[model samples]
Every structure is written in structure tokens, then in C-alpha cells.
Target: MTTENPVHLTPELVENPVGAYAGLRTRPGLGHVVLPGLNAPVRLVTRHEDVKAALAEPRLVRDRSTIPDSEMPDPQAELMAQGADGLPPEYAQYLSGHLALFDGDEHTRRRNPLTRAFTARRVAALRPFVEKTARELIEALAEREQADLLGEFAYPLSTAVICALLGVDAADQDKVCGWIRDFAYGDGSRVLEGLGGVVQYTKDLVTRRRAEPADDLVSALLADGGMADDEIVTVFFLLINTGITPPALFLAHAVLALLDHPDQLERLRAEPELLGRAVPELLRYVTLVRMGATLYATEDFVFAGTGLRKGEAVTVALFAADHDPAAYDAPERLDVAREFGRGDGHLAFGHGPHYCIGAALGRLVTGVVFEELLVRRPAAPELAVDRADVRFGHWPGDGFHLLSLPVRL
Candidate 1:
């Protein structure tokens, strides 16, 4: 509460979030601060407990006009949603638009429609196909002696799963992957400025699916008729793209974590019982999406003695909150078997109604792939690319650019 200068979580800080979040939390004020180049002043919620409390608060809106733009990058989400610019108003109207950015009756209405798509029964049905794909990719990588798991493994794995669920052509997975890259690569400012014509692609795809329905989620939605075209675009944007980028990055980090902690890897390898717990541990340890997207204050509100002004933007940093000393004891230390949610919940996925809908599916895909990654090659290969040398065409959120690694294949 005492700091004068605003804290900006820039692209540079995202590269190594462990230190960045740690350093940001230790500043003079944890509640609020401001940045210069950004459009408006921001209030930064540094601690995990506070961020959790804020995510559930209705007063904190996602619209830019509700919150200051300087603190968080997503204000345009409101503008985009409102059709403030020439862009369609319903651009973010889908499940990816999901509950994360929505509120109350409308949020429920939208989510209720798509809830079944991600149910355990549905995802379980697709596991055989997912497993087959993972093994095939691994086998292909083994043949080459190197493959970037992000590009070659995690990216396609997540992409294919979602696309398949949506009933899109599995062969078009590469094109969807490219669109996913353009959407969240951090360079994108809006549907128009950043992802030029990206929305149009989603529209065209949905139109085609509607013209000729298929066995996918998109076809089902078209049959249901609750979703509008632009809304479909938004849903497609979120569903087909988001969520797994972090896991892709986390996959790379998990390997790094496991290699250094051979005992942990040995435990998982020796007994598969540890896979589920290990997944959370790896997420907790790697802690992707260092800074969660911004949220605006819809009206005047206060939390923990911090008086927040109306329309001021604030950040609920997921990484900083995840690693807060108060949230998790020795959070920096990675323990694969540690009981997550029992001790302290991790915010790798955002909290509350807006939580990542695909979280379970994402974890499922990542776990299956990770399990196969180790099984396919017992000795994790040395990444041909240096850890420091890797870079995503986009910034942190795209996941690390893990293009290739020299494995013991």
C-alpha cells in the first residue's frame, strides 16, 4: 500500500517468472501500483490469497472502461466484446470466452451449453485416440533423434484433442495451431490489431461446419442454435487455442524438473500411481502464465484495507499468488507427491466461475503425453537447444519455443 511507482509485468519478466513474481511480491506495496507506457494506472494484487478473493468478486470487471488499462492487458477484451471498434461485438462470445470473463446468468447460460463436451465420459472416449497420437508423435521424434515437444508434441496434442472434440478435420490441426499462435502470442492487442483476420477464419470454419454438420462440438453447437456466429468465433478462439499453451511450456519445464529431480522421475517411472499427483506438482513447480490477464474494477471496492478506485485496473498475478509463502509452504521447492488442494490450491488455472473449462482435459492430455514421453525414452534426451536460447515467436504465454531436443532415441 505504500509504493508510489506502478509495477509492470513486462515481456522481459515473463522469461523467468520464478524470480519475477518473487521480486514483484516483495515490493513496497502488494495491493496497488501504476505503470507509465501502459494506458492507465493499475493495482497489483501480489499475494495468492488476495488474488483468490478478487477472482470471486463481482465488482472486478473484465471490461477496460471498468478498470485501468495500464495495469492489465485485457481491457480491450471489453472493447472487443462491446464492439467498441469495428470488430464484432460477440467476437469473444464462446466457451473460451467461457466463464472466465463472464458473469451471473449469462455466464451460466453459455457454460451450461458446453459442459458436456468436457465431461469425464466424453474425454475418456477420446483417450485412445489421444494416446495413439502421442505415441505416434513420439515414435516420429525417436526416428529423428530430436523434436521440440512444444511444436512437435504438446502443441499438436492439445490442438488435435480440442479440434477433434469440436468435430473439425483432424488434418487441419496445423492450420488451427497457427491460428492459436497468432491469438495469444502476446503481440496480439485485439482481434483486429493483433490477430488480423483471425476472427474471420473462425467464422468461415464455423460457417462451413454449419453448412455441413459433423460429429464435433462445433456441429453439435450449430444444432443447438444457442450460439451466434461471432460467439462461436470467440468460443472457438478460446477452446481450440487457450489453456494448453501453459501446459506445453509446463511440459518442457516438467522434463527439466524431473531430470534434476531424478528420484521424482524414478518414483513415477517405477510406479504409475504418482502420475496424477505429479501433474499438479509439475504445474505448481513450473508455474506457467506468470501474470494472469488483467481485470477491471467495475465500481469502488476495497479488499484487505486496500481502497481501490472505480474503473482502476488491477492484476491478480497467478504465478505470484501460486508461489506466495502464505499460500504454499516452501512453494519454490517442487514435490511431485505433495498433496495439492489439500495443503494449498494452485492458481495455475484461474479461480472461480471463470476458471479454465478445459483444465481437466488439458491435464489429461499432458499426463498421457508425459507418461508416454518417459516410456518412449527412458533417458530424457538432452535438449539440443539451450534452455536460455529458446524463444516463442510470441512471448511467455505461448509456452517456451521447445523446437528440438537430442534424446537418447
Candidate 2:
């Protein structure tokens, strides 16, 4: 229950979390870990079964506001209760109102409108745009001798697509997305500053959209009139920021993963239709989100044979769960045709009500990226730098936050 023998996050752990968690996964009950972003040590859930269950457990809640003040843990809960860490007031104001931080009816109210945009038909309709954008980017990359795939292709394509959806001006897309990129993936010191810019930009964009409605998500949300101005601003901010990072990072990592496993890449290339399977497999293999959003226990309960106290924070090791040997035979191997396209059981997008809202978009963009880069191309791009030379950003709670993946076309 306590972190007396807590696993401290280290460079080694971030570099290879699956291997680091393997020992803990085989043991009974949950392990304890001191992750960087968390205010206190948390109960670490690693097994595939436990993680899947924990994700949907009603007693486990993402909105800390729902927990009673009396049950809140001392300094840990108090510190987190402060909310923004050290974010500027203007920035924190918008940041705090986002739908992801809410629970129950409030969460449902905020999520319902957005769900219309990500439906199967809607996502399918995006294929053409995704493919066209990818083709243009790939063609540009082909012209270059060597380029950082993340910066040149993945980031641009992701930013452009999300901006198009949100009606971000073509001229301002780069500036807006650059701030989000800096906030999400930058070195520690600049995060708050970068986030400040994003909030301010979103605030102005919201004002513009209100004055002159356009045919985009922002205008649509405004037209719905279900959410207040502040709520709409935060939602817009979330869409732009989340929309860009996950897909961009996933695309870069997918390319790297395939390049690393040539046999799997060849398999995918031969069976071009295997993308549906390949996407989830690569997601499971790479595990973009190293940890799921921290959930606080609403009541005292036993989970995974461990006695969890009310208000205790539970963090799921998503990367570990996806690679869990008990769940997947030959879990370490990257098989494009794994499970014959079932695409079930991976905690990459998580499970339950709070599952990633952008799951469909993430899949669509990354699938299109691979389609343009590998299946339809004459040949795949080659890593310009030694595979070992390429590095991921050392951000806690994020897996495979690729800094730059240099490749030659």
C-alpha cells in the first residue's frame, strides 16, 4: 500500500519501460512507483487484465474534484488541488475547464457534441484529405536529401489536419501548433510559457470564430450553444493540442518501428491491406502513452489483490500492459497480422468512457501516413542516422516521444 519500495522513474525506466516493468508484472498485486508529474507515489497497475478493469472501475475517477475534502490525502491531494502547478492565470483558466478533467454528467455533456465529429462515417470521410496531405508531405520529403521525419512530415501533417478541422487560419497554423508542440514536448523549463501562448491564442481564435462563424469545429461548437464560452475555448484548445501530438508522434514511431523490424515492414508492404491490424499492433508495441491519466479512488477497495484506500491515486502502466507476456503471445515481437485484425485488448487508446476521443483520427492519420510512405511508394525511406543515434524526449508519462527521426528518401 505504501511506497516503501517504490520504483523510482529513471532514464533507464523511460528508455525501456516494458523490460523495467516485466519483473513487477509477474508479481502479485500492484507495484508502487514515483512518477515525475504525480504529486505523490501511486499504486502502479501493470497487468493487462487489471489495467483494463481499472480503466472502467466506477470507484476510480479522473476528476479529483469528485473526491470529498475529508478523504483527500494530505500534501499530495492538497498540492494537486492547486490545479495549474505554476501556469499563468489566463492560461490556467482555459486549461482547467477542458472536458477531460471532468466526470459523470459533466463529462458526458461536454463529450457528446464532439462525438459527432469523430463517428465512423465522419472519420471515413477524412480519408481523402488525410491521403492527399500525406502524399504532398511525402513528395516533399522525397525531394529532400535528409529530414527529421517528426518535424518535416508528421508534425506538419498533423498540425495542418487538426487546424483544418478547427478552422485555424492557414497563416496562423504554424505559430499556433508550434506553441502546442513546445508545451507538450519541450524541455521542462519552457512548458508553462508555451502553454500560456496556446491559451492566449485560443482565446483570440474563439473571439474571431464567435464574430464570424466558419465551417469548422469551433463554429460548430459555438452554434450548438450547449457549452459556455470558456468551456468552448478549453475544448478547442484540447482538440488542437491533443489532435496534433498523438497522431504526429504515432506516425513517427510507426515509421521507426517498421524500420527497426524489417521483416514486419516487408510483411505489411506485401499485405498492404494489413494496415488495420498493423495500426493497433504498432500502437500496442510502441505504447504512445506510457501511463494513463491518474485516477483517484472514490472509496476504499481492494484492486489486483492490493488494498487501496479512498483518495489513493492509481496509475496504469499502459506501456507495460500492452507488452504483458500473459496477454500477448510473443508480446515483444511486432507482427502486422497479430490476432488477424481483431484489434482488441490493447490499452494504447485506453478502455471505457474516458478512452481517447481522438482514437479514430489517430488511426486514420497514421494509417494514411503508412499508406503513402510505404505501401504506395516505390521504396520506403531509410534512417539517415544510426537507429541508436535517434532519440526520444525524456518526458515522464509519455512513451516514444520522438525528438527527431532523421530519414532519407
Candidate 3:
């Protein structure tokens, strides 16, 4: 298992994730690598089949506390120590009660209600509003020759939609968005400050919703007798935060991918209905939520033909799996019309019980954004800056994130 040079996590690799993933796939099965910030050894599952199997295994657990101190990464250990305790219950849950960190019955109980809230029918109903929002945002850029698509279009559109869903007041949307960005992707030291701002805001929102319920999901969760105040706050925190970053990044990358492959972009423009197939393909190509999902071996077992001790941590490389040569015909090609079969499925949203709950909403928002942008624009938008000049930020536990995307219509 030892090598002269192990893969070291770095911003360079994050900037060009596809290349990094391709290299990792060359390993025997699972490759052992050290994450930079955490500075700890983790079993990196790269191949599509191996990543899928690991995700489906019931013996792997999400809770990091179960792992022995000797096995846990220092950063992870520090994070776990900060879990809900002295803080108010609502704030505690907001910090540590996300669905990604739960397992078994508790995970099931929390997820079911949220699942019902984001049904296909419900997401479809949001299409008109999403389209309207996209149109408005795009039209606002009419007076300018060039704009930062990420800030003016993607961020606002996502924030508006998620705020609408969570019953967040229009006046407070900017503040909430700021806090979420800092919490998820900002400086490490300021993360706690960002978390505090979000928790306090969510707690206040929950109280207001409880006193006077609305048609929004937050109100619905609060009214549910089975859910406690802290649980409701936690749900709100997860939904609001997750709702923004992934979709925003997806939009930015989708636009970048489409522009890079003009032939595919032309095909999409010629036949707009292909959005159904195109969105999934784009998701597969851009696997924005690259890392974050980790599983601990509940007991001693062999994974990917390698023996693993109990309580060892495994990080599933969704980006690597999505681009696995064994899974797709031309894994590196960005073909919007590429067809996917059951076994050759993409793991962009993950697999098994922990798959993204907001998958439908994400698709709707992204589809509507592209439909509106491509259909209504006088001409296709072009990158104002050279593609090579574009910059991205790499959050260690999270994935590569686009900081700014400048374009001209």
C-alpha cells in the first residue's frame, strides 16, 4: 500500500479535478491519499464500481465519533469536538445535525419528511417562478456588455429561490447568503462566526414561523408535531445552505462546459427539449459537490479487495467515479446527448440512502436557468476573460468552487 509519492491534496489538483480524478483511477482499486488541510490518511475510493459499492454498504457509518482517536484526522477531531453541547439546542443541531452526518433509523426518520416536501410535483410547480427569476436576472444584465454571471445571475437566482422556499425574508436574503458563503467556503477561522450568524438567524426565523405559519417548507416543518424546535432549525439550516452552493456551482460549470464545447452547445440550442437529457449529462460532467461524504468502517471488512480495520475512514471520490472510464463511453467528453444506463450511472448526487434530497429542485433551477439564458439571449454569451485565466477556490473538505465567472452577452 506504500508508495514513493502519495497523492497530496492541493489547489492545483482541485482546479483541474478531472485530470486528478483520471490519475487516481489508474490505481489498483482504492488508493490511499493524504488530504492537505486534514493532513490525514484516508482510503480514497476512485473507480466507479468501487465507489458505488462502498456507498451501498450498510456496514459503513457516517458518524466520525465512532472512529478511534488514533484513526481520526486532526481537523476532523477538532470539528467533532465543537458539536452541539454548551450552545442552545437549536444552534447545536444547526452545527452538527445535518442529514449527511446521521445514520440508520435516525437518518431515516429525519429524511422522510423532507423528502415529502421536495416531491417532483412540488419542484415542477416551482418552474414558473424559477423561469421568471432567471428571466428577471438575465434582463437586469441587459444594460451591461459584460457581467459576473456567478454574482449577478447564479448567486441571486439560487438565493431568491431557496429563500422563497425557506420563508426567509427578502430583506435578510443577502445577509443569509453572506453567512452561508463564509460558513461553507470562507476562511477557516471565521467559519464559527459564520455558523453563529446562520444559527441565530435560523432560530429567529423558526420562532416567527411557529407563531404564524406560512405555506413555506419551514412553516410546514415547524407545524409537524414530531419535529422539535432544534430539529426544525437544523432542517432549515441544511436546506438553506445546501440549496445554494451546489446549484450555483453547477450553473457556473454548466455554462463553462457548454461554452467550451460549442458543438454540443449548438446541439442544445437547436433542440431545447434536450434539456431533460442535457441537465443530467451536465451534472455528470461537472460533479460540483466533489467530496464531503465520508464513511467509517463499522467493523473489520475488506473493501475493493483491500483489508480495512474497523473505524477507518473512507472518502468517496464522486468526481473520480463520475469520470471513470469503466462507467462511460468517452468519460472525458462533455456530450450533452450521452445516454446513461443503470450500471453505468453517475454518482454526482451520490448513491443509496444519503443521495441529495434537493436533487429535483437543483435540476429544476439549473434547467430553467439555461433554458432562459440560451433561449432569450440576442446572441450566445462569451467569456469576457480567457478560459485559462479563470480562477477557482478549493475548500479542503468541500470541492473546487468557482469564485467568479465573467461573461459578455
Candidate 4:
């Protein structure tokens, strides 16, 4: 049953999401939660079974355009998704071909080309570049007595990987990152402007790649010719926006978690072969995206025994699902050698059709970075400040990330 009061996403909840969501997950039905920046409350599905099923439910669509305005809970609330309320008409085109925001055939059309784009060979090819980038960043970090790993190493490394994959010029990569930062985590005022800048820059990059074809993602997509210019721009836009943040956040958090659990750290270093298992466990333990993308109900239906009306927004709590005791034994505990067979893996990268297309690359990036940091370096980095001084950057639905993970090398 729905609670009498909606759960406000307060600082306490965001700071300790696992504990907060644990209390909600045991409730009989979905919880109505007010996420920051949204005008209305969204139904939060927390159980692993419900979240997994909800993700693949055909009735729940990601694209708001599929359902008419009349069906909405409130027409004005439509724009509130990802802070899009006052977006100008011209800026709308930049959002086209965003695979995560589409549904059914449209999603398939947009995603199929990208699926081919991230082929096994393509991801495998990226490993060397990932390794090289991580090595350089780590070396740079070693020179300093203390370093903010998030800024000094994680963001730069992830940004470089995405930039290299997208054929972005080294000079322009920093600017692109700034635009993304403003667009994603900035205050309300610069959202549209930041988005415009990123899309326009991608458009320019795509145009250049069109003229001078290179061995890059843009060139590869251009070669496919399945998507239009605007679609390609948005696709790259999505990739850059998503590519940099998640893996970077994962890297920073994984380091903090390992430092907190030295036993696990030693276990990982001792049995490097367990890195594969440790990666997923770390992902589950340190959730990057606390809430999955908002999904709108296409029609009235009973979900997890609760009636969900048409146009109601539902968010799968990825953090909660990955930590659900039903799915994972001692869900709160971090195990480096956690054995997860197929169909039972953690939902950290998500599940079903909308599963993150960059899963392999993300895994590759995280693995390579850890290998370089833990195995090659072999020195356990200590927190520069007191444990209490460590702070996390939290955005409404994006979850907590390290603003600056200060570490003494």
C-alpha cells in the first residue's frame, strides 16, 4: 500500500541511500517519493523482482511523446523530467535519437546501430587505450603528496576514453566535459544553454568526421549510414554524457570502498583473478545511478500488486534492487569473490532491452583502471583527510558521487 506521506529525498536519504531504501523496500507496495527537482512524486519500485520486471514491461514507456497530454497526471509535469520544463523548442532536436529516452521500435532503431557500434572487437580494441590513459593518470597522481582522485584521475581518465572513442580532439575534450558538467549537474539557469553547447559541438565534430573519416566511433557510425546527422549528434551526446560520469563515479567509489575494507582489498590484490567477480560486486556495493530512468505507464495496470495509472511515472531503484536481500545473500556485505551466474547478475548496469549499451566498455574501463591502480601500483592509497571529511556529490536522481576523493599517495 502507498504510504500516507511521500518520502522526501532529503540529504540524509541521499547520503545513506542503502539504509534509507532498505526501510522502503520492505513496505508492502511501491513507495511514493518526491525526488528533488520534480513537481510530483514518482512511484518507486524497490524489490529486485519488481524492478527487473518493470524495466521490461512494454506498458511502461520511457518516451513521454508516446502518450498524449490528456493521459498525463499533469501536463506541466511532463517537462519536469530531467529538468526540461522551460526548454526552448530549438534545443529539442538535440535530444533526438537518445536511446535511453525512447521506446519500442524507435528505441530499437536508434539502439540497433549503436549495438553494432559497441561490438566485442570494438570494446576489446579500447582496452589498450584505457590501460594507457589510466597509467598516465596514475603516474601523474603519484607525483603529488595528496590528490583528489575524482578530479585528478577518475574524471580525466573516463573523459579521455570517451573522447578517444568519439574522435574528439584532445584540445576540445576539456570544453566538452565542462559543458556536460554544466548541463548535467549545474543549477537551473544554465541547463538549456549547456545542452545547446554540447549538442552543437557534437554536430560540428560529426560534420568534420564526415569530411575526414577517421578510425573512431563517429567515423564508424558515419560509415554505417543508418542514422541521420542529427541522430548521430544526439547518439554521441548520449554517449559522452553517460560514458564519462558512471565509470568515473564507479572508480572513485570503488577505491573508497576498498580502502574502508582492507581485507577485501588484500583479497583482491592476492587473487587478481577475482577481479572479474570483484567488479560486479563493487558495482552493486557502490551504486552510481540510485534510480533508473523514469518510466511512464502507457495504460492502467497492476504492478507489484499496486494499480498504476496511465502516465504515472515509475522509477526502478537500482541501488535498492542490487541490494535486495531476496536477490543477493547478505546484500549489504561486499564480497570480492561473489559468484553470480547468468540471469542472476546485479542490476547495477541495469537489465532488459534498455540495459546500458556501454556495459562492456564500462567494465573494461573499471577493470583496467583497477588493475593499474591496485596491481601495477601495488600501494594502497590512504585518505588524505579524516574519514568524516569525505563528501559525496549528490544530484536528485543521479545518486552520490565523489566530489573530490582526497587521497595521500
State which candidate has the highest TM-score. Answer: 4
> Alpha carbon lDDT of residue 198, candidate 2?
70
Give the alpha carbon lDDT tens digit for every residue of 1-409 in model 1. 4345445545455434466667766664454434312434456776877888888888876645434444433433442344334544454344336445556677777776677545677777778988988888788877784666656676667766766776657676666656666554433454354344456666777889878887677776777777777666667666644655556666766776776788877777777778878888777667676556667767667764566666666667676777788877888777778786663258777787777777777678868876788744566555565656644442323223344333434
lDDT of each model, Cα atoms only? 0.64, 0.77, 0.76, 0.80
The list of candidate 2 runs beyond 4 A from truth reads 14-18, 36-39, 70-86, 171-175, 178-212, 340-343, 397-400
Worst 10 residues of 1 by lDDT: 393-402
Residue range 1-409, candidate 2, lDDT tens digits: 3567677766457446457788778778887777754446778888888999998888888787678764544323544455457666766656666665677888899888777645677567668978888888888888888988998888888877887777778798778777766776555567876677777777788799899997777777777777777777778668765777777887888889899999999988899989888988898888877777788888889988998888888888888888888888888889999873344558888888888888887888878888889898888789999878998664444344788899997
Backbone clash numbers for all candidates listed: 11, 0, 0, 0
TM-score of 1: 0.79
Kindly report the root-mean-square deviation of model 1 from the true structure over all alpha carbons: 4.9
Task: List, residue by residue over 277-327, the lDDT tens digit for candidate 3.
Answer: 888899988888776467788788988887777877788878778878888
TM-score of each model, in listed order: 0.79, 0.89, 0.89, 0.90
Residue lDDT tens for model 4, 1-409: 3435778776457446467788888888787887654456788888999999999899988887788863544322444445455778776666544677888888888888788777888888989888888888888888998998887788788777887888888888788777776776445567777788888888898889889998888888888887898888877668866888678778989999999999999988888899999988898888778788889888889999788888888888888888888888888888999999884388888889999888889888888977889866657788999999998656655456677899976
Q: Give the Å error, residue 22, model 4.
A: 2.7
On lDDT, the leading prediction is 4
Q: Which residue segments of model 3 deviate by more than 4 Å?
A: 3-5, 14-20, 67-75, 78-92, 170-197, 342-344, 397-399
lDDT of 4 at 158: 78
- Model 3: ten consecutive residues of lowest lDDT: 70-79
Rank by TM-score, highest first: 4, 2, 3, 1
How many collisions between residues are there in candidate 1? 11
